[model samples]
Target: MKSLITAPLLLISGFLFLTLAAARPQLNVLMISVDDLRDWTNFLGGYDGEVFTPHMDALAERGISFTNAHCPSPVCNPSRTSVMTGLMPSTTGIYSNSQWLRPNHPEATTLPQFFKDRGFKVVGSGKSFHHTAGNNPPDQWHDYFRFPWADFPWTRSNKLNYPWTEWQPPPPEYPFSKVEYLRGKDERDWGILPRKESKYDDVVIVDYAIDFLESHSGDPFFLSVGTFHPHLPWYIPKRFHDLYADSEIQLPVFPENDLDNIPPIPRKWAEARRDEMQAARDAGEWEEAVRCYLASISFADAQVGRVLEALENSHFAKSTIIVLWSDHGFHLGEKGHWMKSTLWEEATRVPFIIATPGMENSGQSSSRPVNLVSIFPTLVSLLSLESNTDFDGPDLTPLLANPDAEWSHPSLIDFGYGNTAVRNEHWRYIRYNDGTEELYDHQTDPNEWKNLADHPMYQKVKDNLAEYLPESYTENVPGKNAFVFDPENWTFTNKETGRVVHGRQ
Candidate 1:
């Protein structure tokens, strides 16, 4: 009687009825998460239009693919924390990879916790939550396994000197042919691993996840598979590296003056990695980097293939809801930037797909814009859970059911205090702390190479999109004592010298 979502009854007596507390079948959930995966796939046409994401392409073929999906935040920790907690980085004060939602928003119920509370057995491995200590507390997941770097020979061999700051290549694992030129030698090594599939970190995760799937196939379970690849160091097996050729690699079209007309804040943000892009271009390593990134994508794709195969081969395939998404997008020499933390499309626009077991229009795609923060409510709706978890974005079930349905939700990407981007159906509007703005018509400029904020013709468009920016950016919540927020009037201040900073008080 307590399990409203699942219950069973029995009747046998002549004039009486009996009730039995039996476990009723519920839809199984398989959540696949990737790190730093941009649109450089066979479906998204992100990188040189030659990407080989066959596995992801296959998933998209039968799933509802949102073409304009974006991340809540461009960085890792904040983005994942936001998605898991169903809250925005602005609301939680978790705006960077160094910030964890568990400590910042202690009382918030996470996605996994919600599922566990609703009588679903939750199991996860690898990078599901924000890294240092996952965004979800240990008690949330019935079974939580964090795979170690030392568990994989390839990762253990090339250990980070500081691990967090630098990578130190010890002895070669098995003579993997590596890229000749890499800008950040420590963090950008690309090569092939000669060891068996079990020696890779991602493979280990798949193995654990597959076993979990087999064990909990009958019961209602929430299984998560997180893959860390195409992220950095591009260390994949030689076979995957061979899938992409240096000559076929196509660098993003980054005009020398692409940032010339943009506002100073956004321009300065992209310029943060200007030197890295310049070094690659000058040394003719740009294509090599792209090739490495492409190979990493393929490698991650293969992992997807393995997991999906495992799911399909199991008993819970048809009765499962599969949701695959990346924490945020990545930049492969786009706008003179190498990694995320920018509000541009390259850093925010991500690949998102959902496959409900028996949906009518499963394989179609939607151009309507959606953000990662919506995944929580979307799944809650899909699973039909009765929980009142306040979410910043709307449930995407309608978009999934009908790709062409009316969707008015604009995607929000919060990078830091007073820096955010609002992406709608055809326009992207950005407003910085100094009141400067950048507007891009995605219809005309998908690459975002041109800045039309100064154009007099688009004043109304800017005004319409700017209305969706976060009501109040709590503060930049990553580092220590960098920003102090005054909630009275929604303003930030410099704590060091007690000076009112970013935005008007």
Candidate 2:
């Protein structure tokens, strides 16, 4: 299928910052990012019944799959910042979606920029870093396509052809089109697109990536192909939806009293989605909503298939290293919560896979609890690239070499100040701002249903896990373009004119 948007043979932007020696053999890197995808794929088995994701499962078979991977933060901006910069959100003071990292943490080196500094060609397209251009360093790439996204992103030329008014990722509330099953208003919506596949923005991204892969041969390139699907509004092609039957769709295992057992902070967050859940139940659209999400994921998988095929068919396939990951996990009404931005397992857990060409021991699943915060260092270690700075997460070469490596490093997940969750092999310990705690034994309760934080028997467990939380943390950084944050008072002031805006906690 062709892109509905104007066909560009190539989307190239970036200048050569460093020079590569003629004799050196550079390794190519292919980074694939899927937005808001949870562990519902066939390989993860988090979701019951059937979820169609053949391409991703195939990719998992070709690399070391981190079965127990979690994002630093559940939100898009902060999670991407941590992964790209290899810096934790607490250290950088970037906690919210509005907070931009490039300005807040200027000294840190990004994953692609690190490669660029090492005399490698970096190319990117679509949503690599938080969907904001500022998060993506313009000068770091050899070539990049900043625009050209799924379904009428911008451009007055094709505006009339597509219905911008009705078709989009939900407006955080009800009234879904096409699925007709959703009868009432609620938070989050979904629908299948009736237009041409070329209109899809992600398809254009793959096209640009394929163009680069086929044309470029000798230079070591770091290609980032980002896909914005299965994120929200669940807008996707009808054909992908056909792959799944509604009868085969399985609903999430939502406990009736899950929120009652949740800690204060997360319980409060989960309560906000009460209206959304209630609406879903009232309308009997629970399965329909999940159906669209799974379909959108399958659509995303198809895009991955397209990009991988291009890379495999390319001359550099044998020497390239492929790393596929999502910014964070999504919540399809798991913990009575609708979306991400919590310290729970559903929101923080993500799909992380690393495939290096000719690795002796490949296609293994490492069940070790690992955080995505150190993706920068992990890649650097795998590629043997040089960096001027250190990273929060260390070299996982040992784990990659041996999936059952004895690792004591527990995965740490955080959301703003005073709230953190530490996940080890067995336990998930959560400490909120109010000094209250919640713990879950993953071995007995994979769904994290039973909060054993107050269990007298597990006090030692909490003490030991508390050791993994961040030692030092700054107040949340306010966006320079948007607002100014006062760490001392936990308040937000207007950026311009220094007027007192509002107090935040």
Candidate 3:
């Protein structure tokens, strides 16, 4: 009798232990961010010519890709701030790169801090946050590796004590492109850097991330790895540039009257960078510039491949979740623009992919429009953490389970104070601060060449999309000039008001 009772008790205890472990299993997160990467990968087909991004393509094959994902704002600071804080630009008032995020909203919980608060070892490297002073606070992460800005040797030295400006120029072979107009220009130029791939900063950044993944032994971790490539001064190793040397470079279609029907505000935004576009065209460097961009994309993709390989080989492979996204899209002479900061598809549309362990619908894509702001809440739900009610976006778990789930929320893109764009499955509607409107039917005009906002037939469509816009706009936050920040102390002093606010330490 005693032997039988002891055997049944042991079985019951073993079953209870297994059930508890299954209920709350440890889940790790690996988030990869690429800067200025648009929808030009082999998966998205944003580029017309042949593009090589095997690593990202392979990751997409094993993950659920959101084909219609967009950023909360087209600019860097606001978009990244939205992703970190789970707040939109209209709510946070951080509309541009110059506006610091911590000074404006210090009480908000960042994505890293959320995980860190819940006993996760949160750490990251590279341009995970806006690469500006006072933007990336110390309290958000248990550990972080700041980006090495000295990698780019051509930029101007910061004489005015500005952020990310103190850098020495390279040796005599400075402007490798040798384009006449791009001779002295810093960020606009691109060429082959005469160096080994190991010396590159992105490679270094990935090395740090890989080291962490291989050696981390503790509670579950949230590892963020960001790469600043294809953003500006598109310099990469010679081998990467050589990969595209023999291929035919196809530039984006720039119609003669592309800006004819745009409103004044966005029309000015497009025309703002027209001189850069024209200079490249006149110098006959258009194809070379596009090639450099594609090569940079390939280089970034290689770094991504390295990180993925590290994760796969690690002991945490089966329990980790991988997510890859770009802060915002890039505009390579699309719609008469050279870079981001426009509300058009070229600047707003980005590559978003998420892969979780044991996902039934892995390797599928969702056409439903989504925004990056949902990252925080979705992670909360995925990790079974306590939910925060202040997230501006909804949880995307349903879409993760079923790619074709009924998702009604369209992706919203905000630029300035009142400039907003609404993108759905078939239409894109823009409303400027001056109340001017522009609408394009993606089914017919994927290029957004024609503006149907003036057409009386699309009034209902405009009104229906317009209802999704923000009802009230938050005032612009204080610009960089408005405060004197002390990085060591993590404090901000208003220039005019002389008010001191303690930042995250």
Best by lDDT: 3
Better of 1 and 3 by TM-score: 3
Q: Could you give me the TM-score of model 1 versus the true structure? A: 0.84
Candidate 2 has an lDDT of: 0.74
* Tens digits of per-residue lDDT for model 3, 1-505: 0010111111111332243247548789999999999998998999888888999999888889999999999888899999987788998888998898776666677889888888999999988988767888878888888777655744746432335456665667766666666666657778887777897889999999999998999899999999999788898998899899999998888898898888889878987777877888898888898999999999999999999999999998888889899989988887888888899999999999988876667789999999999887777767766644366777787788778988899989999999999999999999999999999999999989999999999999999999999888888988988988887787888888887877665
Off by over 4 Å in 1: 1-25, 134-136, 151-169, 172-186, 477-505
| Model 1 per-residue lDDT tens digits across residues 1-505 | 0111223221122110111111223677899998899887778877655778889999998788988999999888888887887788888777776554543444577888889888888899878886543244566788877655542233333221112223234554422223334422445555664557677878888889988877774448888889888777677777777777545656677787887898877777777766766666776667776777788888889998989999998888887889999988877767878788889999998999988776667789999989888888777766656655557778787777678988878998888877889998889999987899888888899888888999999899898898898877786544523555433333444556665532211
Estimate every model's Cα lDDT from 0 to 1.
0.73, 0.74, 0.84
* Model 2 root mean square deviation, Cα atoms: 9.5
Which stretches of model 2 miss by more than 4 angstroms? Answer: 1-24, 147-187, 480-505
TM-score of structure candidate 3: 0.93
- TM-score against truth, every candidate: 0.84, 0.85, 0.93
What tens digits encode model 2's per-residue C-alpha lDDT throughout 277-345?
566667777777788888989999999999999999988878788889988887778888777887888
Residue 261 lDDT in model 3? 80
Q: Which candidate ranks first by TM-score, i.e. highest?
A: 3
